[model samples]
Target: MTAAPPSATDVLIVGAGIAGASLAAALAPWRRVMLIEAEDVPGYHATGRSAAFWHETYGGARVQPLSMASFDTLACPAPEFSERGFLFPRTALTIGHRSEAGAVDGFTAQFQARGVEVVRMGAADVAAKIPGVRAEWSEAAFEAACSDIDVGALHAAYLRAAKRAGAHVATGTPLQSARRMGDGWDVQVGGQAIRAALIVNAAGAWADRVAAACGVAPVGIQPYRRTVIQLRLGVPVPAQLPLVIHIGGEFYFKGESEGRVWLSPHDETAVDPHDAAPEEIDVAVAIDRLQTVVDWPIAAVERKWAGLRSFAPDRIPVFGADRHESGFIWCAGQGGVGIQTAPAIAALLSAQLGATLPGGAIGAVDPMPFAPSRFA
Candidate 1:
């Protein structure tokens, strides 16, 4: 006797990272949702390896509203959803050398025009804020709204809330193929078949690949690798140290617990999607850059890792329905601000899926800039 066909779900979300998980939670109250991940655990890629921080200007003006919209949720999550708070106050300082003083002014003016508060600081103030700062760094811009995010807890909260809302989450289930079945889609996952009325491509670095597998036109999403390293310092790092960055975008470092400092070379090497690993030369370059910024002594290299940050040609996140195929949605190209912008992005995506925007926070924000059809 033949077996019964697999049941259909209202929505099938691919990629169980923070993007997929948060979207599932947003849609669960309105539809039957199913989230699938290729790896054994959710958030095994970019979300897991993120140096999670919420900076309004991190993705530039186009992406700032999304990050700002997500502030309330990240700063104070729902009591039922999360007991552990997700965000903590941490200032951000962007410094420039004497030769690049104009760059610092440009950075301040650009964001200030968008109504973002920024304070100009002289070289002496920058040095006082960051111990042992180089003398050549003469100008700086300070953003007091920046904060550190507890990424792991936030990801878990979204996943848990999604499950509680009746969304089915499947990990270690790789999507083999997908084809249009009537008005819905028939997808093969690992060996089982399933159907869904809508497909959300939230696969992060592998977004373009996932779209192609489903016969949807790719949006030119490119994945870039970023490396980060943790160093054990000989001297104690101030617990109140702000996230120090270079205005020229060379490197950034901040203090962590236990006399350790986290540093990144701000590298953006183009690469294909896979489990990324740090290069030895990149690590060396990070230390060398850190030396120029400060006179701190590095005792030892504690840990190092690399993660893929996907971006569109324009660097703005691609969200909304596909122009050619409305059933295929684009939730890719979040860049480095994916986690920081997840709450607002998910809300906007939910609205696109026929749900009314609660509180209308995202409704007031323009969606034209992030529409996927812009690429088409």
Candidate 2:
């Protein structure tokens, strides 16, 4: 599954998921870039499986900036980068049981303090928005600015932009090993060997594994499985149903076209890096939890899938050049917010790689907190 890989490059990015693809697009104008993917196609794993949304509060405060910074681009990208915007108007609601009112209040206040447009919803407001929810599930907050991301278009645009900027992508080429030489690293992918001045670890769930393959110290990147299932509901649903979330992080569901809904248990089971699949127990739990919140009958589960959400030890994004190994960059550990934060993170990394720091919130984002030096 190896494409004809280059013999040498200024930069070699392992794992051609959103992280690598976005960064490749950002840096390609200034550097010779090549991206290698283990799968026959790019974004076949986590990136492809993501039910992503550009919600500001989804990743908590520390990650909010990247999501916020990337909004303008995701909402409206340059004409050369994308044919259209990737964000669609789909707001979010963080609901809690009556007993969890304080939790909902705190959640709303936290984001409201950050200048997010949010409204504290009363019981009636909650019931009106999500028709079948239980009376006990009254405490809620609404984020009008939350939007659903067009992940496919966003990712494909980055890949196209990168290729247009002279970046080479070799699909089905996995990094087998790498060794640091005098001025460059010798990387072996399958039977092909290439020399690169710098190697970017954007391998998603395989981030730590890639670092080990290069004899670089691992940053404790761990993968967790999140399951999402599609259901054919027994009741008529609103066409513009907002994304309903549990403030305590137990479950989330949103309406789809027709009588369908996408639901998740919000379970994060720590697992090894591999192709993830939905567990039946998790699916059952999801249905049970949703039942507790709403009377909507689930006629049948039409489809189910799972994906990995990788995170570093601190549960924050890891970016910038490695602390001890500047030639190696860590662009993994974005957890679930990687898609929303890609534009900012990619720009930050490009800045570290010699590109000018971009203006706006991306420039205000301090890369130090996300730097790999914390792990060192």
Candidate 3:
């Protein structure tokens, strides 16, 4: 026998990736949160396609604080659901040629000020860090604190914790409609009507569409495509080679375990909401950049794919409910920092729902910076 579906919930979340699941787990303790995923399985998009690197100094200005706020949860993952260490040993090295020397110096100083172990390394030092690199091609570089994230394990940890907290997670559930109903909103998904006191838009690339569907102002969320290629290196590089990035941000590569390497051209091409495919031109660019710095032979590309990273106009995540609307919350526009900053964003949303903190969990940050009103 099927249990009768409730007409309402305290919170209705769209998308079951890191953002939605983490938000659900945080609010389930105080609210009846129902999470919906369009796919049969969760994390079908960017969350699944991530390169899985976790560098505290990598996010932009607005994202840095949130990333720092989430360190506690990720570093010390909940024992029951997530036991694997949050990160593996891998440093970050931003490499630069003569033309990019100034930018390299600026980056080094900025990271050093943030308590990161950042220091300018010459060609020889860079070679010491990563063997087989062409010294003449590399003008300057800096190695700092960075690591690889356990993307799958961390996402699952949040999902399990959310489920155990009594939150409802519905995969293969597509939200068909949303409308205002008295003090809350009514949403229909999977042929079942659910009333939710608050509707959190955590739908990643589809966030703007979801907002427009619910009569909330659109936040101009643009999804950009980023491609990554994996290859097996013939030469044995450092066991913990830092993620080497082109100083101008044109390309980057990370040494994976067991002599595997991941390369990206840092392509930020704008794209629509859909499963993105890696373009040949972009992959070729990555290959060319990788060849320029290292004297390594190009082996076959073992795998390649692309993901949609949604960013707001200002590239900051929108975290609060619409000021005019009583129950429509915005938890989208995470961009590429979604996985690393999930905890703080979830706590911010929960605070808004519980009315415990002012300006939500993002505390002290100007809400207008990420508010949908800016688009209006």
Candidate 4:
């Protein structure tokens, strides 16, 4: 059964997605934390809909550090967190056409310079891996560190840790509004007003809306929809087929269970925050693009879905206290890399909330680049 909202708390975390849940877990041990979710269940929107992968090069240079810093937590967590890791090994191969050789070269060189293991592949090597021979698509960069993330397990672990640490999780409760009252906040949710010392806008797609309700200035957090489809191909799905990605960002597909493949067109259509559903046109375009990449005929479209990826105007995640607001904080704008970077982001935010940050890669990485002050 779900718990009722608290009358007051030291910290109020809005949205119970990966962002909110992880932060709650990090802060609950030392603070009176409460997480309120608008939906009946948490993570109903973006976090639940992700076709997530833990590829260090997926989110560019700014996000790579967070992803890299978070790997240990996900792959070899403390026994108290989870007995087993939530990541499975799967290699990633980023390919480009003959004409885009320069782009492929630059892409491989860029990540390689960052110390990511990237091997330049020739036509024969690419053919040996993919089994499809398209003369045009030859040049490729192979990354061995890419792995499939068990997103559900990770989100659940955070929520469990938060609950175990005595954080209140109220379901079907949404933040109606908030006002600065002295050094704290007077917040309304689920028909009652609550007092909170700090309010965190970890609302994902509705981040800007949450800010508006809190009487803080909106930071232009935009939501974009990304589509994915499960395709049953005529050819047998290779047991060890790596994740195949287009260097130009056209599409990516990886093998799934029961001889099916999961594919995405890398679409980022901007829209208002809401319950996102995949459009037929987006699914069709993905199929068309996939056909151009591999000769495997599609037997059927087994499943399809869409999710929202929210981002700040600068495309970097926003964390830390708001510029002018006294007790309002921003933990939004994670885009699509939220799951992979959850632990690092959580650690950074918890430290700002007064918890001691443990030393390691997370402590070493600078957080100024992702601070909310940059937006101000």
Candidate 4: C-alpha lDDT: 0.91
| Residue 306 displacement in candidate 1 (angstroms) | 0.7
Per-residue CA lDDT of model 3 for 138-222, tens digit only, reads: 5554655577888888888888888898888888887888999788888878788888878889999999898888887777889
Report per-prediction Cα RMSD to one decimal: 2.5, 0.9, 2.8, 1.1
lDDT sort, best first: 2, 4, 1, 3
Which ten contiguous residues of candidate 4 have the minimum total lDDT? 1-10
At residue 80, give the lDDT of candidate 2: 89
Best by lDDT: 2
Each model's C-alpha lDDT?
Answer: 0.89, 0.92, 0.79, 0.91
Q: lDDT tens string, model 1, 73-177?
A: 898777897875799899999889889899999999999998999898898899889888889987999999999999999999999989899888888877778
TM-scores of the candidates in the order shown: 0.97, 0.98, 0.92, 0.98
- Give the per-residue lDDT of model 4 (tens digit) for 148-169: 9999999999999999999999
Q: How close is candidate 1 to the true structure, as a TM-score?
A: 0.97
Cα lDDT tens digits, model 2, 170-275, are: 8888899999999899989867889999999999999999999999999999999999999999898865689999998999999877688999999999999999
Candidate 1 deviant stretches above 4 angstroms = 1-6
Residue 314 displacement (Å), model 3 = 0.9
Q: Write down the lDDT that model 3 would get.
A: 0.79
Ranking by TM-score: 2, 4, 1, 3
